[model samples]
Target: MSYNDRFIRACRGERTDRVPVWYMRQAGRYDPEYRKIKEKYSLLDICRNPELAAEVTMMPVRKLGVDAAILYSDIMNPVMSLGVKFDIVPNVGPVVEEPIRTKRDIERLRPIDVEGDLPHILETIRILDRELDVPLITFAGAPFTIASYLIEGRPSRRYLRTKSLMYGEPELWQLLMDKLGDMVVTYARAHVAAGGKAFQLFDSWVGALSPRDFERCVLPVIRRIFDELADLDIPKIYFPGVSSGELLPSLKGIKADVIGLDWRVPIREGRRRLGGGYAVQGNLDPAVLTGPMAVIEEQAADIIDQGLEQPGFVFNLGHGLFPEASLDKIAALTEFIHRYSARQLQNGAAAKEAERA
Candidate 1:
């Protein structure tokens, strides 16, 4: 309505009228308007123009009535400041011009100068901060996921090249992770300073690693990113991406206020694995939206039911929404989450009052 801080309240583990719902990649190819814009401007092109980028972001908040607005920028947007060359190919994803293969390549990464090199990104945040009623979630890719592209040159089915570098050149991998971690902290801090209300560190590919490797090789940098930003008053989120169920236990003591769960694990089980002390977001399979509206509500009902069992929960997809994802379904699902969860909350309160009586 006026200003929805429901998402922020849930993240801080505070009381909310209902569970807030916002999907990853909520503002993308899924909408026809965005598709038209995509034909004219590349994802990077839109991001480089703050006005256009802010519009792309707010489209979802207006259309679907989402609880928050994630910035319409890619994780690799900051890497250009670090002097990496990559392109978000039409269907291929991030393709590195020169994959970081040696100590030389890793060392070659300069520190990010966000205001100097990425003025447009900050401008986009400033625009959204003034425009939107919802909190603006600005994000960066976590080290391992960015390194997966930097090392592998492109997305790999097995991430063999990424692991080979991690296993064979442990010191080199650590160096790369350190540099990337620094990039994320700088980039994220700049966003918050530039008027971003909250932040999310997307470690999308980190789920590919075993829990042992995640702890030994990746978790330190992940922990450091949050620790560096611990002073910020706004909510911080770490989404360990799809298939990250096994890596949950290894993520103990991460300073994030919210931990995102992919759909592979149930919400309660994912929370159980986290061992407490953070609000939980997501685990809805985005593919479920392709089915009938009745089917969609049935599935969303299960996630909301499990979510309402706990104090801090936000309704979201386990992963980003795909191009084929229906706008109508998403809008309807948003309405369903708000209405259904409100009634559930009211009923629960009534039951508790009855017990007291």
Candidate 2:
């Protein structure tokens, strides 16, 4: 099967020729060619340039042979289009000008004009569909992650503003979350319409909340977003970061087709907790790519082995690729998945056939 078909099938809990491998942030800083392109254009600038974004998006697929090409854009792009002032700092992540601290602040936020602020993203997806041979996985921040930045106005080690509001001003927080969920559904549907084959919702900060807080404040909004997109028939990958095992049970009622496991959660444990109904993606440490080739190979093999126990698995790093990650290691890791994963699948199938015989 082709990579696109294999990936979509994997997401749907259907049998495929092999486990498909792709990477989070596979199109960015790890590749030297991407770095060169970034020098000529800012991250946001390139994201808004359909030609340039498409070129960067296809780089990792061409170089590392990943099964999917994620669109070259940051999660904050849609948030910015929602009337928030933001900037992507050099080493730092996103910084927003004002956080929504009160009910008035939440009410002040406007709905995003998907066509106006993100026309280039649509154009880039169009180009990618035409030029790339693999699946195109577009992404958006889950309501909680986007709300974290909007509430904190920047990356925070403590996420104090976010929690304070969640606890102190429950009504306001709910309103804000509801608005963000609406934005996610709108943005995601637009991406699907623009030719993206699948979507991944990055709830990068959900682990920051306690299980009670997560259930009360986060899951409902996430469910609404996924529920809204139910008719799209595209695979929805939900990635909740850092020790998110506690949140998995709450996801059972959500509409996501795939649950993305971060490095902190073991894939086996994740599958067990999440049950057998949905596909699971990731759980490999991105830091492993910075280690020796042998170490990377061993770790990659271990992750693939764990993933095989599940019906649907997509090979990926737990999080985005680090800027300092070794490109050679990534290339080796990709090739390893393509070769070793396929062999393992073939062996498993043969064993099953023999057992039946």
Candidate 3:
């Protein structure tokens, strides 16, 4: 009932009554209400209306009672400011109208004009800040991930064109990463200024690179984005997307508050790889939600237990929610994480007190 900062506290590695929970794509088609709204208005259409966008963003907060509310927006939303035209095609994902291939195309990208081009987005953040009980996480796609879409022109499985450019045209690749990094730095500043309580940089496709290639190609840009935002006091998160376990050890001083783990690595192990400098979030397999309720609780408890072993941890899916994921199951899972972790924490505190006595 009261304003809950459990999510925020966890991000800062503070102890709480329980492990806070929020899914990656929490406000999605899985909810019957969201589906009904989608029938009336497209995802982009909903985003253009600030009041409606804010309401859609809060749907899961009211329904499943998540600890944080991520802004309901496409990562591509900011690219329009860079003069790229794209569409979020139904069932396919983001599709670029004109793919960037040449050096001139990369140079053509302008610094993002957030207030001028995406006023509705900032307005939505303002509305959510005034209304929500939970922290709002405004996000931007990391340079590599955004570059993947912009280069490939659509949802890609192999990213052949993207990698060809990265490996073949190294100088050209740096130029693109630089501009995209600049856009993220500028865009994120605007979100925080507009009242976003926290920020996440979604590098959802960066895991595609080998550790050597990622470090050589993308890590500099990643480092710069977080470094530029170091003045923002809110928690910052870096989700390196699926299969990113191998990429963790290289993130030594990226300045993010949390490093999101895919289910490929256990929470404790992921922290070890990250060298324990930052708080950790996620690694729960989102697919486990489609299984039996018992399976869901067991898996969630395992993650929560490992999370409770440390001070800074948040409960969340390893990745985005599936469209067919059950809403009832998600709501039940949230309650389980809250109730079970709270009891576990209380028991541990009592044991410590007894020892002191």
Which pairs clash inside model 3?
Answer: none
Give the per-residue lDDT of model 2 (tens digit) for 129-200.
898788899999888888888888889989998889988988888888888988888999999998999999
* Candidate 2 displacement at residue 244 in angstroms: 1.1
Top candidate, metric lDDT: 3
Runs with alpha carbons beyond 4 Å of true place in candidate 1: none
RMSD of each: 0.8, 1.5, 0.8
Give each model a TM-score: 0.99, 0.97, 0.99
> Tens digits of per-residue lDDT for model 1 on 161-231?
99999999999999999999999999989999999999999999898999999999999999999999999
Which portions of model 2 show Cα errors greater than 4 Å?
1-4
Clashes within 3 Å, all models in order = 0, 0, 0
lDDT values for all models: 0.93, 0.86, 0.94
Candidate 3 residues 188-295, lDDT tens each?
Answer: 999999989999999999999999999999999999999999999999999999989999999988999999999999998998998887989997898898999999
- C-alpha lDDT of residue 231 in model 2: 95
Instruction: List runs of model 3 lying over 4 Å from the truth.
Output: none
